[model samples]
Target: MRNTPDQEKELDESPLTDGSDELYERLSLKVDKGQEPLRIDKFLVQRIENASRNKIQKALEAGMVLVNNKQVQPNYKIRPLDEIVMYSDKEAHGEEIIPEELPLNIEYEDDDVMIINKPPGLVVHPASGNYSGTLINGVAWYLLQKNKELSEQDLPRWGLVHRIDKNTSGLMVLAKTEKAVRSLAKQFFDHTVKRQYMALVWGDLVEDSGTIVAHVGRHQRFRKLFDAYPEGDHGKEAITHYKVLERFGYVTLVQCVLETGRTHQIRVHMQHIGHPLFNDDTYGGDKIVKGTVFSKYRQFVDNCFAVCPRHALHAKTIGFVHPATGKDMLFESELPADMREVIAKWRNYIANRLA
Candidate 1:
């Protein structure tokens, strides 16, 4: 997502002058099973550090509090296992980025944007203990190498329009110019970008093609993890349309097209539907959620896990309008060697069973 001369001209007259920044606020809490009933606002005020009852009430009035993915009133009673989420529009802060020289898998680049095919385990940007060796750091160095006197603050997000998880390999676009950033960010916000992911989830999906509609937000208890609220009582709306591609009795390969870009949308939605991505340790796919308990079967699954060693998900296809060219752009990547090898192993295992 980059800007061009034409894009610069278009930006001056674009109608998207207002509300270009992504709106986000988050505070999720999973009620303890042993907790007794209490007013939700009171409960949140007690738990949320520096939270005031008046502010909590205001947030509730603003429809910013959710219980189990559905908006709730301040008087709502908190129940055990109830997932609560509260959010604001204030932007979260991040560490000042530093440039690194890590290698990047560049797929396409232009004056306004760069499309990268990120490998698994490589974080997209810096955070916490990971202030260096991130994709943005490398991108900074790349720009520096090109004699673009860029600084850590030159691009707050280092031109990243969007990002994938640390362990999820995929295609991502980075805007190289402010105009491109605004244009691309608007597209993402408007849900005009086409993004598809390939995932190997546990079990055979009942339907060939369907959409998973849920509200996705942080897990009530596991602050680091996310959960899907099918009851539509808790989080922001998230939609994932999936079509079955291939099936191996115990596992299935599917194409998931995202209608909404929530954190871990595919992973959370798939898991909510009872098919966590294979080898996804975070969402409980690392364990055997399906299949037989036989020793040989266990060994076979173990081998497959070793082959991939991470969640069996890949961002395979991405389509978007170029910021500079104002033309539709589509990019696709083949399944990684690890995923391919594991799929082959499953094929052979099934075949040998028949033989």
Candidate 2:
């Protein structure tokens, strides 16, 4: 779980700070003496227990496999004494998702998959403090109601392919069958899946379109929050491309496209550049990062915070190839009501200020 916000909380069960689905692993191995040249995927498959060749190859396609610190294809041959580094992303689960009768905003569903429009303040899955009333619990109950009853072993993590933070409302795809889970996992692993989010940051961007490339990892001091390393030395690689959509002087609305899913990629990247998401308490967006220190202005900002008491981020669109049909699937979601109301307030306030 991540520190999104209260009321309009941002919560995701992903291992990455971005709240995107996937737990990344870094592995390094030296080729032994008299080692025969083998394809990198095959090499990883043989060396890493419980990892399949298909999964390893998927990691390669996603540019997670590297030779001498450079991305390599699955077919790349491993040479002796060559330093090999690999990054692999996979789903993490603790136990079965217990079925609970809770409200779920299911967008689309079929035999193979289900598309969900997750609402803010909803935990995606059960964790230590939140063992019930999660999206996974609701999903489990929904699936059981529609499909045949099955043993606990039949399901894994409620077939979730990835996650968004709890306070960040957005679209998520869930697999229905074992094959769907494996196929969807491959898509995410390969970085072929497309994810876009809409966010309101506390400052105006200098450029209408720009990219934020940084290394994001857990904060050394505040373990709950993430810190961005713009130098790109430590932490996972994260790239976020943004285009300004609307600007409200003190805040700007932008659309963010993710090339790599790292924990808190958007929030941390924005904050690193000095524009944290509005009302993102964990990242200090809750304070007056932008605008004047005047009492009147401060009061206005406080009013805005009360209107939308959470980080201003929404997963607006997600696109991927269907696991079973091999067809392109894209889903879009409208901004939630709370976000809409807050943006409206900003618009009105700006207009009045100009007048």
Candidate 3:
């Protein structure tokens, strides 16, 4: 319920700043000194009062269960003196939202839903170390300006149906009413919502179109970052279909369609195939991953990075059924200036190289 376009039951609910997912500790316990070796899921069910096995399994699969500060599978055997921690994605409700007079690019709004073209570097919701200056605070202010009464209890997650990463620029839909919340949530949960993203990757894609099937989960070493488990041995299933839109010699522009909207799905999937997003520092695309080894080439890439400081990704298109009208609604946005400028530089660089 925290944030996502999919119905994934895990602690990684929403995309946060730096593409990290915020997790809240729900339970912590240490195994007995002489405890028998049992599956962690079973151990939790037996020890935790009023907790069901199903819930424990869900947490384990979601990487919410950590043993000795490490993520483990549900079948992991509990050892003596094992420190276990469980986390939940549920946000603390009733937190007072401070309304801010931030500018909002409201594309479409009505009694049911409000479509916003969120700019880059704007956080969708407030999290730790970011109590204000977020899109949700602006939304609160906008609603209050219209003289609409807001109750945190009634409007969960600040009426945010889903979210993209803070550094990723894109279109987002917010629920304006309780009915819209339930309806849009159902659409996302059912995976009926359509989302497309534009990304500039480091390498030239050989295939015109392809599908990437992997399990996306938090990286074992870098807990804040995510990785793709191509073997499907870890994490939840994620699928991304990408088509090559344009090809520069060193980089390529691609359009990604999400089949399952896991956190950092497109980023992880593209990185898994050795084509990390251009300038995406978290996924290891900040440095030059392609191009010649000449210093001039290095300087060129550095200039491009300066032009587009963040990851070169944009939520260019989103389509979903109108909650109240019961009609299909589609919205599209052009690439931001930074991304456009960077692409233009690449075009010039490639043309000169060919000449």
Clashes of each: 9, 13, 0
Once model 3 is optimally superposed onto the true structure by TM-score, how far is the C-alpha of residue 292 displaced, in angstroms?
A: 1.8
Off by over 4 Å in 1: 1-94, 155-158
* Candidate RMSDs in order: 14.5, 9.2, 10.9
TM-score-superior candidate, 2 or 3: 2
Top model by lDDT, which number?
A: 3
List pairs with backbone clashes in candidate 3: none
Residue 19 in model 3: lDDT? 32
Residue 287 CA displacement from its true place in model 3, Å: 0.5
- Candidates' C-alpha lDDT: 0.79, 0.79, 0.80
Error of 2 at 301 (Å): 1.6
Q: Write the per-residue lDDT of candidate 1 for residues 249-282, one digit (tens) a residue.
A: 8999999998778888899999999999999999
Tens-digit lDDT track for model 3 on 151-240? 544333536767888999989988776456556655665567899999999998989999999888888888878889989876777889
* 1 or 2, greater by TM-score: 2
